[model samples]
Target: MAATNQGGPSLLTRTTLIVVAVILVVFAFHALYVYTSERSEIIDDIELDVAESLKRLSKSLGPFIESYAVNEYESLVTTEAALKRHFAVIVEDFEMGEILGQPYYLFGQLRQGDGQYVDVQARDTSITEQLDQAFYAGSAPIIGSSGKVLGEVWVYASDDILVKKLDRALLEELFTVLVLAGILSLLLTAVLRRYFFNSILGIDAALKNSDQEGIPKAPVPSFRYRELAVLSNGINTMLDSIKGSRENLKIERRRLRNTIIGTRSGIWEWNVQTGETVFNERWAEILGYSLEELAPISIETWMTLAHPEDLQRSSELLDKHFRGELDYYECEARMRHKNGHWVWILDRGSVQSWDEHGRPLVMYGTHQDITERKQAEASLSMAAGVFRHAREGIVLTSAGGTILDVNSAFCTLTGYARSEAVNQNYEFMLASDHHNRDFRKQVLSSLENEGVWSGECWIPCRNGSVFPTLMTIAAVSNNDNEIEHYVTLFADISHLKQNEEQLRQIAHYDALTGLPNRLLLSERLRHAVSTTRRHGDVLAVVFMDLDGFKAINDTYGHASGDELLIVLARRMQTTLRECDTVARLGGDEFVVLLPELSSGTDCKPILTRLLAALSAPVDLAGHSVHVSASLGVTLYPQAQDIDADILLRQADIAMYQAKQRGKNQVRFFNGMDGSAFNSRLVPPASSDQSEKQLD
Candidate 1:
């Protein structure tokens, strides 16, 4: 082979002589081709040329128009100026054309007739696309007092100008081709006579005389024709093609390297020769190493960063791949991050190619960032675990009150475990037997709109024990306004409920005998009066005052009186039916409100039984205390539309009448019913009764 080229031509005087001759011929052909192709194209560009020429002409004319407008001339075509001071604005830019005459194409500055000479309307815009056929509106549109629209101008460039331009281009191209061909033909004959003929003949003689080397033919041929020029040019072009191919190969390699690095995945290259490894900074950073450590880097160093649990398996996979038993190695394992924590990575490596001898040479690969994926999976698992081990009663339902998720605490609270509650409607726990239906609707409302709600609810336990609970329900929603779940947290309030009921009873009843006290009795009295008034029913208020109970307390002490009160309270309780209201009005006083009565006649029997019970007395702490009460009765709705207070007072006054007749007698409050006259309800002293009473 004639010294086959590897990268570039060797520096030799003989080769230099030949290359110069070839370059001269190539330039000759290049000039020839340029002349041949561009001649007609330049000729065809006449229209564009005219437009450009016009633009230059218009630019030169701009200053004169500006000056005429500034002088405020009434007519610029008719006016001449010394224009010495204003010479600067009037100076020609050369490209601007002279203003043409009347009936102009665009802005007409010239008046068509006489006095109607158009005031100048010189345009501010340069190269207005609006004027394809050129036009001029004169200087009036320009500034200053003398400015006037002088005249208008318009014209299309003639086709004759374009034809003349084409003719000139053809002459120039012919001149260029002739000049190029004559210079090339003369230079080639001289170089061929001086260089390739003598150079090749001398090289052949030297090679033949040395006689030690193989029989080699000369690359340059013996020639006098232009074929030698063609041949040399062809060889130079071939050399150029090789140079381009090598440059393209280098570019491809650079692009491949960049693509690997830019992918954000950690790229790595294993060089089996030097036992040195090159890794992308990302790869090293991902594995807790710096790029500066590359020279000292090895696969062994990387293995140390793998998680202990995963290291052995990763090693095994690598071993198998290296032994040629496997084509690739892949495993998910933890690699320490630059921050020193192990992050999970999917390590994959492929056998991209082998060397000529079939020996493993280079491996190219990358590691992907999977930290987020791993964390998301772990978060999901953790959430599931928390749900499994939760302690507070948690029941997650749909917005519609259907149970979706339940925890052990919920089961413990509702006496239903996860297995039983998950598939059932949450309303099942509402205890349809006890809780109102309207409350369930409220719970639904809270879950759908407010995202939270809480109140007392009677939830049925598994054993059918219904309990009141302070429940808080929350709505879970996504980014969109759609409800995902309803979470209910309930704290058992059964004890509070029981205690509250006991408190209610203690508030209204006398703790000593479990009988209605004054507060409850007054309430009942009012209710009785209202009912009697509304229904035309008869109701009575009977008041009784214990006569001897204080004496019993005075002798046996208050302890014994309290006991006596209890005994008498029980006796009075049995004296009347459940429909009647009896209340202890402090001290030794008691009152009864009887409803649904026919009249005071109905209360009469009740009063008689009460008095007998009180008179019978009871044994208290070994002392039999003889206790009697003065009883009085009053009718409702018969006198003055009697309210609770008036009826009770009247009954009390009647009781005083009984006291006057000596204790234990039951009296009816009709009128004339006071014994001590201290009762506010006492009827006015009878004229026949009081005057005689005083006497």
Candidate 2:
């Protein structure tokens, strides 16, 4: 019974509030409508009142005023009387003198009551609301007949009786407003209690009592009573579940971001329709930009970072990918790395996500640094090629002397094909077998200790013929200096041996007479002089110079002179036996190397044969030219002990002494035997030579 009674009051309060609000609203609307109608009527009434007053005033003064004004009023009294009559309607509020003192007559007026005039001096008073306004409160014009408007008529009036009644009716709405305010408050409280407040209370209760997971979900609403509450609770539960799911999704996304960025892998997403792209921070950085540098990415950003050489390739690949022809987008190309250097990367990518139409929406990829590995492989390939194709015989051996690698040059050098030489030991191929046993042990031991052995050795070829070779062997090592292999650069030196002998012959032997030159002569002289000094046997060095050879050269050319010199060198070489050495000093000069002379007189036969040999007429270049040589004989042992140069100098002086004696001659030096003999130099002059020249 008590609950029922309480419910009744609550219901009654709610019903009363609604009823009061409707009644207040009805009254307010009615008041506003009535006020609006009354205001318009008041305005119309003021206008009509002003018009009526003006009509009455005009009627009162129109006839006389118009008649006098039309006559132009020559008389003051006539004009004054007419003006006085016109001002009568507006003269009531002013004194008679003041009214008559106004500037001009009044014909237009709205107030016709009690001789109230208007417009007495051309003052505009066309509108008058004060006379008939319901709420009029303003000043009005007070015209007098004094020809001067003395004052303004101030009127304070209330709205007409009907308007006052309307205003009074509006004022009377206070009791209804109070009733409406209380009722609205009650209604608002009831609605809040039923919907918002009750729902909020339920939520609070659930929050307090529910488990940590969330508020326990309530059952679905079926009835009207608290249906909104049930629905709100259901929405809250759904929102909690959604929030949890969203948070889990956020964590997963963060984990994915960490994986990609930690690996320095770039991720991208593209919208086909809009041609918009999104790339992660590291991905942008890989292209030499920060996340902020390129965002809301477009084709322009990709194009800017892409290598110019790869532009067309990337475009074609993209076109093909969009056509569903390729499943993967993988490429190993150099993308410009950060700081504008090209980096070799393995750019492997896959279509991570796609739209319903099979269009690529997102791509995930990775870049791997493989530049070192690539370079090492290329280096190895080049090394192999050079070793196999080199012109020099390059052989690679194991540290144990097993030949592991050999080039074409090696095959050609040994006259053995590559296959025949492969597994052979390097020591077995050497032809210097007499020294091999000891040499091998030393070389192998040295190579083991020092990692290198390089020297000259004899090696046998394919035909079993032996040849000398210059070989350089070096051990290629790692960082630790452990021998990885041995490289032997060797070449056959057979041609070099023959060349060496030829060079020796050219250096020591004269080409003209096939006799020893000054070099061989000096060498033999040293030995001969050493022997004579030890054995007490005397040695002689005879130096000879050709006399009158210039006459032969001038008569015939250098050819005849060379032939004569050749003959002279040969005869001197023949004059001395094998024990003696004869060599050309140069030109027409010669030196003899004599050893084991019995006496100083033994040089006498050598000198006689040399002179007899030069006496023969020599045929040179088909031209016979008479040539003779001046001989200087110097005995060694007798001339104390002088070196080769001083000995040759003595021989040269003795020869000059001989030339001073006459034409062709020989001179020998004596031990202080200054047999002063002047070389009666006969000049090719004196008119006597002119007769001999003619003869």
Candidate 3:
């Protein structure tokens, strides 16, 4: 009771101190505002006065400068002192301040090139220092007859005069301010002591102690002043409300504690100044440690356990919160668990109070486990990296076949940009006519049954080129096992298709002449034989060997011989009907199959043409060489029942007979008699020709 009754500064004394502080603040603010306003007004007036003086001086001097321009300063005073005398009268006419008084206005003219005073009739040499102190100055370029800037005419007003005027005005205002402040402070002090001090003390006494019910034990009476009565009544009302708030706060705190306990999240409080930390049992459990085992924990315990990679960033966020750059601190970081594995924690906190200098005094926050979330994020990042960098083209589409995203490989394969492909139907970029309704249905069915479809397709490119591709289409499902999207992976097979065609050509044709070789020739002969037998028509085989070809090859080289063979082969093909076949059976030997013929006689005309084409002179390396053919003709469906191979052999035998009968002649084999039925010769050229035959 004695301690409670100990005297301290009285209410009246504290109130007086507050009033004095308020008065001083008001005085400072008023002084600053008055000084700034008055200075601004005076500066504006001085600038305007300087501008007016320049206008007047320019008007007075314009006639003189123009005259000097025309007359070349002949009638003007050239000496500086004489010029200053002439300008002094003009300056006096403008009602400028007295010369002996404080310098208010100064005028001068200076040569533009040298910065020296111009030798005008009225240059004022003594006013140079005053002009240097000018706060406001104006100048007009004095141009000469040649349109060059000869000098500048200037007028100025010094700030010294303006400053002196402001000082006198501010002194007068300061006296007025002192009188007003004194009167206001006296009135405020008297009013507070009479009307507010007693009432406020009475309310303070009533609130000093409370009964078990938390109601004020002593009642405060109303004051004589209306404002004092209102203040006393407001304190009583606030005390009653405080009792109800305290009960509600208790219930709310219990509910909050239960919510925190149900969540099983760690709670913590940190004393920033003392470097101490308090943690609940759940905080220790999050890291697989018990409260007793981690009992003597401080902030350093958390720092040491935090993963080194994460501690720096977490600390930065906490500093931001402390410095008020952020409203709160929230960071996800890892800590070393008791089991030696890193555990992720989401730490969140905010300053609860600050010291006098605004440093954080206390911080409160919680921790939550987020290891699973970080793991999932890492997995997602890896999948995204694969999609971006994979070699095979991959396209992701919506379930409805709308193109959603494509990897770089897909863009390269289809020649479509990502912007052009997205939001468009997948068929717009990669699908060909082969992707018909049936194909789509098959894909959908496979997705429904097996969740994937792999097949070959022809995909189209942006340039209207189509190429084969091996594609795999898969269905992507959500957690509920419903199709969310479709993934398509494909590889371009155009090069593979080209390689296959090349291999087929290599297997079936002569590489030198690009004609059907023996293998392809046999196949064609069999097909011709079958067709001729079925139609009851004749098929003839003419086998030809070039005459003097080996002699020409030995003389002109194999390269020339090969060229002659290619030329002759092409000529033979042009001479025969399109249905007929010409094939190279080996060096200098060829077989022609003529099908759908009426008789062996129908082949005579073709044979004659082949001999004529082969006998023509060929130009090889600028040398004219001539080669001839020894032809043997045979017919299919003979009475002896000869097959294609037998027929070939029979024609070959007849060819040997033709070679014996003198080269460059045709011999037809008569199957009924098995002899050379007929022999014909290509008519010889004129005697003047240099063509000669090999022995």
Candidate 4:
């Protein structure tokens, strides 16, 4: 039979070699078993002989020990021929001791004899220590005349002779077994090579001569063995199947290529081991480039174009796919475009081939441009974030005004939770008194015609309080221009309204007395004069200067003066009618407007009351202070048409006249001419008459 022409050893040769190796191992173990068994037996025989010699020595030592013949005992133990075969012999005298209140014998006297038949007094050596020095040892106790233990005799032996004899025998037996195994292995190889190896060599040659696609060129010849014949037939059958599969795979590849082209997806094939990559034209086009522009493409090219932040994640997914932890590698990463912008890509791949050791070799995948989709998603995320965190309260409603959604800001502003506010009418957010049905209809009409409405309105809260808000409602329309929904934004303007009121108070009122200042008083006076002309009534403009205010202010400080002024202002305000206006022009100077009067004499009672209120004593900073005002009165609609400033000048002239005359006296301005003023010393009126005049 011809030997196999294949490289390395054929199956028959390798099998025969393995059989020879196994046979050698078996025989070696068998030799070890026999050698160990015989060696153990020889050592056992030697130990048994030592035990018997110790027994005899113990018996002979007994009489000598009893008779106190120490020399005889040593001679008997040392001179024994059987004991000479042993490595050593020991003799120990028994010592008496008590343990746990019980008597016991202990080996005390130590005597040793070596294989040379020389005896030694080993007084420092213990019997147990002497026994440990021997390979094998045994002991027997000597019995005295009273049947008490007098001493112990021990014999120890070596296994040197046993080891030497067993090894000599085992070497001979192993040599014969090795020779036989070698001869038998040669015979088995010859038989197998003639039958099994030759048939397998023929099959191997046929397989080796196959085409590049690995399909056998010719069927394997039949073998003498039925199993080998069947194997040859199976190989032929597999070759035919492979040939058909190759054809089908070509068709499938074409179909898949067409499908990829139709879908406009970028196809990529990667030789993972070589770091080589192949990309379709679409792949370059997705990044706004031509395939020719991205020259010399490789795996490194992909890595260079991919976003640096996404590279680590892509590598992790690829590793997982390679390790079989994932069926496919999928990643969404940004790639650098030709225009210097980032383009989003959805990358998906699977390992297509592996090496014999199961490492990834080749992979195929598709790259899809997802930039638009990513932009849309980003826009949606931004809108959602705005809705969630914006400061202005936002509400979404259907066209019919049913609230559909409310944002966190709305929930916080209105004191209503999102779950509580949704599905209610939009009117629930409107203050009932401020936004009536007609107001709502007007808002709806504006939204319908103009598609938006915005103004300041009061918003009702869950706590039943209304807050001012700047609100805007816009109608969302479909493509047909029909209203679909409404989006309302409410900015709480309560703080703005409060700020306006504070600014008005600071600008138009006295800081100390809380009375209208000169700016407001002048405006009111002009309006009052205008009203008197329309109603055909008279109006009085009274100007007053405090009599003793400067002295009190100097004595008790400005704080005390301010307190007194505030108290006096309050008293005068209360004394006058509700239709009157009281204003503090400056330090201790004030103006009072009494409009809608029937006649000029109608002001006398009010003037009397004003003088009494101003003269009253005020408790200021633990000090009692009394102050009075020099009053001057001027009636509007004088003989000549005059403005508010002329009336004020006329009243000032009358106040100076009254002050010259006496403090706490009222002087009336003569409407006939500005040269002289009418002096009227009005008597103080009772509180009841003051009330009646005020009514």
Candidate 5:
């Protein structure tokens, strides 16, 4: 009963106060209405009086104004006692000198002491200014006999009169409102005490005896008034609802607990003010521990287990959540596990309740173990790094052979940007002149049969140039053994190809003159023999030795001798037909093969040209040097079937005979019989040439 009484004032006192407030409001509105109406009426009456006086004055003064009777107009306007009594009057004269750029008016005032009209000194004031100074004003026009308005007659009363009238009316209204409000409050207090006082106290008592959760212990009894009775029934219904809601809340809490357990997430509750904390069993399990092992838990326990680098960030996020700068706190941080290794945790929470001062009081959150996810992310990052920075150009293509992606090395090697390369066909990088449809089909077949294909290829670039690359293309398959994509790895092998070409050049050609060496000449000679036999054509093998090459080498240095050999070799090569071959057998010794000839005589003209070419002067070390050749010619299909070596020996024997006969001459091996060879000298194509014979 004391608690109910201590809550606030009794029902009677509160009702009286409410009634008094309502009465005061009503009186205020009524006073406002009365004040507005009375002021309007007073202003209207003053205006009417001023208008009537102005009209009478204008009528009396119009005649004087029309007749130009200035004195009479001034006299009539000034002596008008009725107009001057409550208003200031003026008579405007059209013929008067201007004041303030307007017609000056004669001013008149009524003296309050004697109630007489008196003229004041004329002042240069505008008529609009005079009207603004008055509370109420009216005007009429003064006309001449010709019906033209000469001037205006304005009458105005002072603001003092309107102010005095409003004051007296407001005082009377306020007094009446006060008296009515006092009587209404007293009557309201008595009525409320009799009808509602006891019923309100009973309701308060019932509410005070409610359970801890605020469900009422008993329903409010019925009241005498219909409104109070309805309120009582509503209170009883609310209590019944509270009981049902409490039971449902218990069931929902159980279900939520079960759901949390099923998800395997850790649950935590914290009292932010007291530094107290509560953790579920799963919270400890996430860190590889039982709840018993983490006894006496508090907020400090979490801080101790958290990685030192993460504590500062966690504190900052917690502060932001407490200050309402964030809707909730979420952080991914590492914590020390029971096994002495760091474990990644996803910590999320929100402030569930606040103190009266709006500070954080209680918080709830969950923790999820994310160590495995973090490890996977690290692995993916490492793989991406390798793909981006590897030395080899790597290409990823879809199963349909469209380029999906390429690394930086690919761009560097192919001279195509990543944007230009993606979505293009895989063949865009291949040299079109080097590779054809058959080549692509071969590559595809290889991949289908062996899952990989690797070889040297020419790759074209954006600048219209191509390079050699060692390319390896392999089919990438998924777990279902279906080919999904093709991964191509290639390295620029232009330098390696260059090295191989250099090695080949060193092996096949003469070091001094760049002519075919003995090894190459032998190979070509064998091939030529076979071709001539197949076509049944005549072939000539010529052995030539320089007549005076050793004397030139002795006279000039070996360098000069080499220079002469190079120049002479090039001249001999140009002098012969494209079907013939000229090779450097050794120092100052050369061999020439003439194939596809109709007869042995077809080569005589060629041999003469060779002699003339070798005899030409050569510039060596600033001196002109002349050299000639002793030539020995042998034709294939001799009397007895002869091999390439026998043909060479016969030509050599003929060359010895030519040199013995004379230095510059051509000798032909005529025939071979068992072990002996016959030699016959052949004349040059010109008439000045000589011939010789030997057996």
Candidate 6:
């Protein structure tokens, strides 16, 4: 094949020729220049030699002419002859001429007796070539000894000497250049031919040995020439690409087969024009039927199996796919299985070929069984509903503590909007500023180790008010068992805590007065009695009744009575020492337990102070109510051991005695006066008498 018509002529040959031609041309020009220069130099040297010879000739003739000025004509002629002979030896093609006015002559041939100057122009034609080869010619005037102008002498030399020397040198140099250029060209051509021939041979062998598929089985042979090596590499790369494409095609075929077999997908092809359809074995298997049983099917088969409601949507999607409105046809639809059960299917397809008029001729697609997926989606939807409506606050966070999701309850509890909470770190919500780096690290460590943590923590709301919550943090793990997120559930227990506190208060204290009631008072009194016995000191139990409390209640209403009782309770508490205990037994009655008392005298001052405090006028409902407290004082460690109840009863009896003995006075209970202070319930009449005395 005409050298396979590679891109151009062989590069090696072209480059070698170009290089050799450039060298030869350059050398030829140099040789010519050197020849011309040598010739010129030879001519110059000849001219210089001629001029020097003329100078010597003139100097020699100068002496002759000077001597001849006084000599005879014969003597002068003889001197001239001698001078001519001297000049002849120094110059080539030597000639000596004498100038007389405009006429000139040689030394030996003067035309006339005075001066028949030899005319150089009158030379024989036979010697004209010789004369034309003249190197240099010049004339100089001879001066006599007295400085008189003598006849001029002309000298000339020919170029024959210069020509002879130039021919010899130039011939030698020309031979050298021709020989050198020949050898170098031959060497370059040989080297280039070897490299080009070998590279081309290797390439041809590679191409010839290539596979029938036009893909090389082996790499192209390497080359010393960089461009040729690049060509080889390019061919090898193209071959590799072709091989890779074939492998990829095979892999794709296998993958398509595996996809049809492995997944719950059934492949199908439909010829739109022919109204015929083809199904793979998997297609029939998905619907609980054998391929043989479903053979010889048409488009009507699908129409019959597809649910009526889904048929319209699937048809619409198919029409859109045909119109190129979508890249593919995809829909979830229900189709009746062979067992008469409706199976949800995910159908997807694309146009495989088109007709000349841009209508779909053939389409291919798959039907994927999605019944399980649908059920799972329903379950997930239920779970989502629970997450949304659960009462407890729920937060989902990344492992890095960035909040990813929050329920409405969380938004309500923390007083943060959903938009504000998402993507925010939970650190800012911790109530305590002192929960520093170490504390946070411990929390993370606990989560990583235990996967769950539960504790009470204070969380601040967006309003900057903090509430206590029972918080539970659980780590949610991914399929790899790595902690991917955190699920935190917390409930605000502040109201629960408040209820517990209220119950405690109601159990131990009087609601209206906020003072310890009878139960708490008795408890304190027992402890006080024990302390008095241990320390060898007296413990006073003083019981007091407001004198006219009932009348005040009757006149101003019950609320005013409660207000008076609250005022008296506060006054009674403030009148005692820090160690003292004051309590309310019932309506209009208060008890004081003073431990560490030295004697009954110690009780007198406290009882007096109590009466004064009660007598202070109390403002009630815009009315000032004057009331007095009648105190009955009882001492612990008196006569015999006594319990807290008996101590209180003795105080009550003493209080009645004080009331009967002109009310608003303190009475002490001792064995000597225990009979006079009888413990009996006060009658209504006597209580009225006491109230009148207070008024």
lDDT of each: 0.63, 0.63, 0.76, 0.82, 0.81, 0.74
Ranked by lDDT from best down, the candidates are: 4, 5, 3, 6, 2, 1
Model 6, 596: alpha-carbon shift in Å?
7.9
Give the alpha carbon lDDT tens digit for every residue of 569-671 in model 1. 8887787898888888888888887889875556655665665566663777776656666767777777466567877788888788777865556666764
Candidate 3 C-alpha error for residue 144, in Å: 99
Clashes of each: 33, 25, 6, 0, 0, 6
Predictions: Cα RMSD each: 44.1, 59.8, 38.4, 45.6, 46.4, 52.4
In candidate 5 the C-alpha lDDT for residue 661 amounts to: 76
Output the worst ten-in-a-row residue range by lDDT, candidate 1: 81-90
Which residue runs does candidate 5 get wrong by more than 4 Å?
1-381, 428-439, 462-466, 672-695
Model 4: how far residue 510 lies from native, Å = 2.0
Misplaced by over 4 Å in model 6 are 1-390, 397-408, 416-471, 480-482, 493-506, 523-540, 551-560, 573-581, 594-609, 619-623, 634-642, 668-695
Q: Report lDDT (Cα) of residue 51, candidate 3.
A: 59
lDDT of 5: 0.81
What does candidate 4 score on TM?
A: 0.42
Better of 3 and 6 by lDDT: 3
**TM-score, predicted candidate 5 vs. hidden true structure:** 0.43
Q: For residues 1-695, could you state the per-residue lDDT of candidate 5 as single tens digits?
A: 12334666665666678889999999999999999999999888888778778878877877876667777766676666454466467666664534336555555553333545456436433444554576666778877777878777767677666789899999999999999989887887777777877778778788888666566677778787898899999998988887899899999999997898789899999999999999989899989999889888999989999988898899999999888899999999999899999999999999989889999999999999999999999988987788899999999999998999999999998789999999999877664578897888888899999999999878888788888889999999999999999999999998988999888878888988999898888889899889988999999999889888888899997998898899999999999999899999889999999999999878877886887777777777678888778888899866667688878888888788778877577888767342323333343333222333333
lDDT per residue (tens digit) for residues 1-695 in model 4: 22435577556757987989988888888888888888888888887788778778878877877776667666666566443566666676553222223233222222345334444455333544665666777889889888998777767776667778887888888888889888888887888888788888788888777666556678777777898989988988887887789799999999987998889899999999999899999999999988888889999989999999899899999999999999999999999999999999999999988999999999999999999999999889978899999999999999999999999999899899889989998877764577788888888789888999999889888888888999999999999989899999989989899999999999999999999999999899989989999999999999999888898999999888888888888998899999999999998899999999999989987888888888776888788777777878898787789999999998998898777865677788876666435444443443211211211
lDDT at residue 619 of model 5 (Cα atoms): 78
> How do the candidates rank by TM-score, highest first?
5, 4, 3, 1, 6, 2
Ten-residue segment with the worst summed lDDT in candidate 4? 686-695
lDDT value for candidate 4? 0.82
Show the colliding residue pairs in model 4: none
